[model samples]
Target: MSDRRDVWITGIGLVSSLGEGLEAHWTALSTPAKPAVDETTYAPYVLHPLAKIDFDQQIPKRGDQRQMEPWQRIGTYAAGLALDSAGLKGNKEVLATTDMVVAAGGGERDQTVDGAILTDIEKQPNPEVFLSEQLQSNLRPTLFLAQLSNLLAGNISIVHGVTGSSRTFMGEESSGTDAVRIGWSRIAAGTSEIALVGGAYNAERRDMLLLFALKSVALHSPWAPVLADPKGVPTGSAGAFLVLESPEHAMARGAKPIAKLSGVWSERAKRGEPGAIEALVDEMIRTAKGDVSEGTAILSAACGAPEPTSAEVAAISRSGLPVRSVTDRVGHSLEAQMPVALALAALAVSKGKLFAPLEGETLEEAFEGTLTRAIVTGVGHWRGEGVALVERVD
Candidate 1:
């Protein structure tokens, strides 16, 4: 670790319920208003759907546009934004060598087929046979192929001409933590020069909603901050990506970095291990190389799920740094959570301030001065916990 080069966040591509890109999100966040959440669309379970996206802006070809599922499209679009932000878009020479690591969930479910089978279940004497028959007949091979998580990385390469070493991770929230971690590790170690990393998640599917409900974790009340939520984690749709490159690589091309990705550490502890998360947070702090200072702020990826959130709150409290949860503004996005928090932290540090609190969360404190460093935390709703440090290069 001592012989490594500095890793910088040269570009960020992020889209969530709040807005698109850094400027739009920063503006919305800084405004003194309640977090924008939809309680009626999904009823009891809240959702933060993405703002309208003009697909043509990123995915240009009509045929190419039609092939990708919603999540793939979202990731592809955000990847383009990150490439553009890093001043690498359409630069064939630079892109030819850019590495990519993506964290993504499974493809969208064929809901119509699933619903028809369910409704016809009682009509058949052998429900299991009928279910099996419908699944085989109704699901197209193309749709089946699209379900592979790596298709997102493939789609980005096909559309954006980023034909480099591409890697995709598929764990829930931890997938996000590892995606950035791996990409940053490569650049810092100088084995590779620059890399694109991040993840995307679509929570709009009935199947996904059902998945959460089966676990009894879906929020069933009005929307509020992660700290204020009386229920549990609500679902949301978001996609985030970042262009991480070695400092030397960036300076050679005159790419001004948004922030430096100083360090990233991830851990998975058993949920059954009571009080394990507090120690996980401490482990993350210890891994950060101890540059935390008065100018540092913490952007929490605290899922509104009760137990984990409570533990994260206590852990962050022990650090005594000013804090805010982007999850408070945007609902919980499983695979995209870590990168989204990192993107927000990069934007906040680049602009030198934290956003205004959405009102009602007592843990939030407005940053008093310019942000020189930030600790981005992710305490997964179910099993994993991680934290990352992004420092101002100047």
Candidate 2:
């Protein structure tokens, strides 16, 4: 009865290392290929860099573009694409009421300032005092203001005029899972007629790479698919956003659905505890709506962390469904991880066919037939696990 309201996915905006738009992804993935990676630049670490994009196409103002960080620009561009795809970009009536939910991390670091401070620290006898003084003198007044995570939502409101209520979530991968889940729940509950939900990540930062590498969570070169690696995730630069609306609203607007989102469930597992992740994933899957027996494939957001990946693989094996890790192709996008997978699911269901398997055997069963449903699973590198069941509209 709760799911009777029927939440529909009407528009999706996606940009990744593979490329942008639904067609680019589908075309590349349909072929047997490996993920695009940069082995020498990061040296010893692999990264999936974003494809070239003309920012002026989506973000017209150079001033607005200059003020925001790369991640914000990526998110703003993707948001514009989503609104355009949903036929709501310039519809002031609809834009005025369309809610926005963004999942994002803290802003990128000011590496030059950081470097200057570190360089100056060693020259002072009282390093603590020097550190404080340098931060005060060198950092720009606007630097701190620019780092707020909610700026993504604010920029979206300003750029696209999506002036409805806005919200932002901060936890890594789980943040993305909850963004979509909350959007769908609000739409289905009739509290919101329509919403834009998703996130983005900029992996081309020295600070980011170092931060992740410190945790030993960055994949080294001589790259391998997510499931194949036991070391860490190969992070990528990507932005994904989706337009979700109630079935009634979509029909009233004459906007056809790309897929139907039945339900989503999420949980955080206490790591280092055996069986914790397995049990968490199993429960999330069981709680989701739609017929599990009809699932065509599991689009896994397994972030290639040794512990979580192994446990996710085990849990999904029990579902007896073919599984393909999105990280295998695009690498992990942290907060954008789940949203990207959800977008991929919508694309797959709309086509009514599954893409060729990246890791064939476990997910190798050929379905030379129409596809109707896909189960999306997101297992965080360290903490969360989420599952969603999506069905074809036709």
Candidate 3:
């Protein structure tokens, strides 16, 4: 392990309800303010809407912008921001070999088409036939093409020119966790000198709300801190990406590291079995605790879903580390959750402090000491569990 190259996080691009870029998010989270929530838009279901952003600033060509879906646009825009942050934008020489890993879900649904079919199918005598006909007629070939999960990587490559090896992972929060893990592992193993990794989610869709509502995991009106109200998750629109580089590579490019990525570990637990999640979480924390001395806290991506949230809380209490739930501020971003948590963890370690705790959350305690390292934890709403250690470079 000592012989492995040290991996550092040099650039971070984060866009959430708090706003875009690191400065905007840091200021908003470190201060005393309410989470940007839209309660009435979804009616009975709460969500964190994305802030208005001028697409031209990041994605210049109108033609390029028009072809991408909202999620793709968000990802491409964030990827550009990360390249710019690392001083790698338009650096054709470096970008030609930079690897990219993306975590994403399927494309947004055509709500109008879906609505029409649902409304009309019930009235038809032959409901199955009507549905089949509608599906064949209403769906466009282009719409199906847009649903490819790898398109986010393609768009980033086209717009940002990161033409290196590309990989896309699709599962939910686990995908985001694995994306970061693989990117860091590659850099540390000397297989890749630099890599871009992250994911995005658009939570302002009725289809997404309906999907969660079906599972009864969609948070309703009157948004409360996720820790205080561990009943359901309020999805938020967000995009998060990080530029990871080996120490040698970063120094060669004169890119300063914001924080050191010490380690990343991921696991899956059988939720049907009692103590399964708790056992994995405890093991991960025990392993991560070996990397720090003191002044370490946890940044948790514990979505407000009841089971996982409670399991994560028990593990945090056992670890005896002060913790803050990232979901409380940004909302549950599904595939983007782990990347968002890591970005914020790196930001916190770089600044030497943790952000303020949510107003009504009794579980989150204030940390008055310098933050030397942060352990970011992501317990998937249903299946996956992961943890990563982020520490100050110096």
**Highest-TM-score candidate:** 3
Q: Whole-model Cα lDDT per candidate?
A: 0.85, 0.86, 0.90
With candidate 3 superimposed using the best TM-score fit, by how many Å does residue 307's alpha carbon deviate from the native?
Answer: 1.4
The positional error of residue 47 in candidate 1, measured at the CA in angstroms, is 0.5
Candidate 2: misplaced stretches above 4 Å? 115-143, 289-291, 359-365
Model 1's number of clashes is 0
Put down candidate 3 lDDT per residue, 1-394, tens digits, no spaces: 8878899999999999999999999999887567999999899999999988888999999999998999999999989888888999999999999999999998888888877877888899999888778768895524688878899999999988999999999999999999999999999998999999999999999988988888888999899887766888989999999999998999998999999999999999889999889888989988998855479999889978888888987887788888888998999999999999999999999999989988888778788999989998888888899999999988
The model with the greatest lDDT is 3
lDDT of 3 at 27: 92
Superposed by TM-score, candidate 3 places the C-alpha of residue 67 at a distance from the truth, in angstroms, of 0.6
Every model's TM-score: 0.94, 0.93, 0.95
Which stretch of 10 consecutive residues in model 2 shows the poorest summed lDDT? 359-368
Which candidate order results from sorting by lDDT in descending order? 3, 2, 1
lDDT of 1 by residue, 294-332 (tens): 688888888888888888888877787888887877778
| Candidate with better lDDT, 1 vs 3 | 3
Give one digit per residue, the lDDT tens place, for model 2 in 1-394: 6445899999999999998889999998898677788888988888899988898988899999998999999999889888888988789998899999999999887888877776888888999888778768886534676678999999999899999899999999999999999998998888999999999999888877877787888889878876655578889999999999998899998999999998888888888788999988877765653355664777888888888988887787777776777887888999999999999989998998888876433544566666788888989887888998888875
